[model samples]
Target: MDHVIKTLTPAARPPEAPGEVPAAPLRARPSRAEAEAAVRVLLGYIGDDPDREGLVDTPRRVVSAYDELFGGYHENPGEVLERTFSEIGTYDDIVLVRDIPFASHCEHHMMPFVGRAHVGYLPVERVVGLSKIARLIDIFAKRLQTQERLSSMIVTEIDTVLKPRGVAVMLEAEHTCMSMRGVQKAGSRTITTQFTGVFRDDPKEQFRFVSLVRNGIG
Candidate 1:
């Protein structure tokens, strides 16, 4: 018995402006009842009795969980770093926030990849709140993502918003899709990084960022 899984194909989009992070294309959304119906279908596909007393509300619960898990789709990354402060006098160096814990679903499998992000930037004239970096990470992590793309998105947003002299981003994660399924190699971790401006241009600065992230010192 061959079963087909339906997927949504987004229409072609125009080219994005330089330095702009491309957003997910808009598509017609299904109603809550329709979403729950699909969840029931998934439960049936897994050979479970979705209508059983123990599972009767599973569809509703799953739908509600998904709403919370994928809430990033409704957020705007541009707004995350909107507020900046420039009061620091002549303090122009790397500002790093390491060990920012995050959880994201892999775009391919929708399985979770739990990780920590290390972000740093060389402030030019202004700086954003340290907490905003963590919030920015959450905004991107709550969406379907690849570690590489997620790293790039974070760097780009910081560079665009802060116009920093450099930006650095590193992500270390254990992808459940790999450990829980293929090869079943549990406890394996993946690392990804992105650099721009001085971080990309100078090996010394890049090494400093890496060393700082690893050693927790300049």
Candidate 2:
């Protein structure tokens, strides 16, 4: 099937420094009733009776589900790493949180892509709690994203908040849009990685991070 692509020109903005959080683009939001009405339209588009017994409440349920699925937009990424501990005596090494499971919807199709994220950072003097890193992953995962941009955003947020010497992030996911539709290839995984500072500058550090991610200490 052929797809029609529309090109949109965005408004110009001032330059942003590295690690600077850009302002979110403003958009007029529809009311809950309007949103529900839109869902009913979609139901009708799919050749279903929106007023049918089983589907009578489907619009409300779908809107509620959307609130949970896309809650990231309402969260603050900066607050996730607001607190850090700097008292560790000479502990300067990679802090890795592996096998963090997450689910996100694709921006193109809004289909789910489930995955595991492996995140690591070399602390300069302070470090945030391990659970905070997991929360950081969740903050981004609950939004509509592409795997590549997701990995970059995670790395950028950690680097900006923690000011680590370096950051390494790897995401492995299977997009349902591909498996359930399109080519319909099942059991295929897509892996994306982003490295900054030392991890990006030095091959050895990148290798160590990858090795630790692949083979945890025995």
- Which is the leading candidate under lDDT? 1
TM-score for candidate 1, please give it: 0.89
The numbered model that scores best in TM-score is: 1
Residue 205, model 2, lDDT: 91
Q: Write the per-residue lDDT of candidate 2 for residues 6-47, one digit (tens) a residue.
A: 322223232232455786765666778988999999999999
* Model 2: residues with Cα > 4 Å off, grouped in runs: 1-24
lDDT of 1 by residue, 1-218 (tens): 12232232323332232365786876667778999999999999999998899999998999899989987766667676888888989999999999999999999999999999999999988889999899989988988989988898889888887899999999999999999998999999999999999999999999999999999876
* Stretches > 4 Å off in candidate 1: 1-25
